[model samples]
Target: MGVKTYDAVIAGGGLIGGAIAWELARAGLRVAIYDRQEPGHEASWASAGIISPAPEHPGMIPLVPLGKASAGLYPRFIAQIEERSGQRTGYRAQGTLQALFAREAREELSTLVALHHGLGLACDPLHVEEAREMEPALSEELQAAALRPNEACVDNRLLTRAVLEAARRSGVEIFAGTGVEAVWQENGRCAGVITSAGKTAAGNTVIAAGCYSAGIGGAGSYAPVRPARGQMLALRSPALQIERVLWSERIYFVPREDGRVAAGATVEYAGFEKKLTPAGILSLLEAAMELAPAARDAEIVETWCGLRPDSPDHLPILGPTDVEGLLMATGHFRSGILLAPVTAQLVREWIVDQRVSLDVERLSPLRFRDAPNPAS
Candidate 1:
C-alpha cells in the first residue's frame, strides 16, 4: 500500500499541536499528528490550567496582549469543540484573585492596578475584608487583593482530549506513540515527517513538539526551544473551598470542579528531568499553608512535574520559518493551554489564506538566529 498523504503534518501531540491539527482538519484539510506518547500526557496534563493575562511576573506583562486575544476566543472555541467531541472541557470564567500577603505587597497593588488599567484590562482592587468575604478560604493575613475578571481557567487535560477527538472527527489521522525521528524534507522544503511507523507526506509540516522541538533533526538550527521544568502538586480538599483561582507572590491555587485544589509550581532551569524534588514539594506546601491555613490538612493527592518549552526571551516562537513549508507553534512556556485557541486560528489563517491576522513578526522562528550561545 502507498503511504497515506495529508495536507498538513504536525510533529508533537500536546495541546498546541492537537489544537492546530483540529483547526486544520476543521478547515477541510487532511491532517496527521505524530507523538511518542499519547497526546497531552506531558505539560498539558500537568498544567494547573489557570488562564490569567495579568502577569505572574513583570517579564510576562508584555505578552499579555497575546494572552488576552487567546482568552477572548476561549468561549466560542470551547463551545465548538465540546459540541463536536461530546465532552465537557471544564472551562471556567470565574476570574482570578491576586492576594497581597505582606504590607509591602499591598504597596505594589496600586502600581499593578495602574499597569492593567493602562492597558485597558479589567482589574478590580479589593479591600482585605472584601477579599476574605469573596473567598473565605483566604488567610486572614492578606492585606489586599485584586480581581482580574477577564482571566479564566480550564481543565487542560480535558480540553486536550476534546481537541484530539474533534480532530479525529474532522478526519485527522492521529498516530499516537509514533515518534517522528526526522524531518522528511524534499527540494529544500519540509515535505513531511519520518516516523517510527512510516513516512507521512504533507504539503506543510508543523513543529509543535514543545520542549523537545529543538531536538528534531533538520529543525535544530532555527527552533531553539529548551525545557524549563516546573514542579506541581495537587491536593484533595473536598471541604476546603475556593471560588476562583487564588494567587500570591509565592504560589497559586486552582480549585477543580471535583474538589481537587491544584497548587503549583516551582520554576527551575533544570532541563528535561521532571523529577519531583523534596524542595519543590516543601516550597509549594509552605506557600499553600501560608495562603490558606486549611491547606495543610488537605490530603496530598498527586505530585508531578512538566517541562515547559521556553525560548530565550520567554515568548513563543510561532509562525513560519526560513525553511519553506515549515511552520512553528512551540516555545509557549506556561501559556500553551491559554494560547491554544488563538494559535489554532493563527495557523489556520497563515496556511489557508497565506496571511496571518495577528502580527507575529516578534514571534517569528527566525528571531533567534543571531542570538549568542549561553555556554559562551
Candidate 2:
C-alpha cells in the first residue's frame, strides 16, 4: 500500500486544528488531524472561556478587530457545532463586569472608560450600586465598575469536545496519538507531514500545534512559538450567584451553568511546565475571595494548569508562509478561544478560495523572517 493522502493535513488536534479541519471537510475537502495526544486536552480544555473582544491591555489593540469578528461569528458557530454534534456548548451571553477596587478606583475607571471609548468599544460605566444589583456577590470594596454587554463566555471544555465531534461528523479523520514530527517538503513545495507513525502526503499542510509548533522540524522559523503556563482553579458556592463574568485587578471569575465558578489565572513564562504551584493557587484564591467575598466560603472543586502558545510578539502567527502549500495558525497566546471562529474561517478561505475577506497582513508567518529567531 502507498502512503495515505489528503487534501489537507492539520498537525494538531486542538481547537484551532479541529475547527479548521471541520471547516475544510464541510467544504468538501479530505481533511485529517494528527494529534500527539488526546484532542482538546490542552489549552482548549483548560480555558476559562471568556469571550470578550475588549483588549485586556493596550498591546492587544491590533487583535480587537479579529476578536470582535470572531465574537460575532460565535452564535452561528455554536449553533452549527451543537446541531452537528448533538451537544450543548454552554454558551452564555450575560456579558462581563469589570470592577476596580483601588482607593482611586473612580479615577482609574475613568481612564479605563476613556481607553475603551478610544478603541471604539462599548463600555458602560456603572455605579457600584448598579454593579451590585447585577451581581449581588460582588465585593464591598468594589468602588467602580464597567459593563461590556456584548462580551460573553462559554463552557470551553464542552465546546472543544463538541467541535471535535462535529469535525468527525463532517468527515474529518482524526489520528489521536499520531505525532507529526515535521512538515514534508517536496519539489520546493509543502507536502503534508512526517509523523512518528510514518509520512503522510497531502496537497496542503497546516501547522497548528499550539506551543509545540516550533518543535516540528521545517516549521520553527515561521512558528517560533513557546509555552506560557497558566494556573487556574474552580470553586462551587451555593450561596453565591453571579449572573455575569466578573473581572477584578488580578483575577476573573466565570460562573458556569453547573454552579461552578472558574477563577484564574497567572501567566507565567515557565516553558512547557504545566504544574500548578502553591503560590499560584494561593494568589488565585485570595483574588477570587477579594473579588467576591462569598467565594471565601465556596468549596474548591478543581485546580489545573495549561500551556498557552506564545509568539515573541505575543500575537498570533497566522496565514501562509513563504513555502507554497504551507500555512500556520498558532501562537494565539491568551486569545485562542476568543479567536477560534475567525481563525477557522480565515484558514478555510485561504485553503479553498485562495483569499480572505479580512486583512490579516500583519499576522502572516512571513513577518517573522526579518525578525530575530525567537526560538534561538
Counted clashes in each candidate structure: 0, 0
TM-score for candidate 1: 0.97
Q: Where does candidate 2 have its weakest 10-residue lDDT segment?
A: 367-376
For each candidate in turn, give its C-alpha RMSD to the true structure in angstroms. 1.6, 1.0
Q: Model 1 clash pairs?
A: none
Which whole-number lDDT from 0 to 100 does residue 226 have in model 2? 89
Q: What is the total number of backbone clashes in candidate 2?
A: 0
lDDT of 1 by residue, 1-376 (tens): 7887989999999999999999999889989999988888988888889887766677877778888899999999999999999999888899999998787876789988998898778989998888998899899888889998988889888988988998888888888899888788888888888889888899889999998888887666567888888898888775568889999889999888887888999889887788999999999999999899889789998888999988888888888887788898998998988999999999999899999887778888888877743322
Reference-based TM-score of each model: 0.97, 0.98
lDDT of 2 by residue, 238-287 (tens): 77788889999899999888999999999999878789999999999999
Candidate 1 all-Cα RMSD: 1.6
Candidate 1 regions with alpha-carbon error over 4 angstroms: 372-376
Predicted model with the maximum lDDT: 2
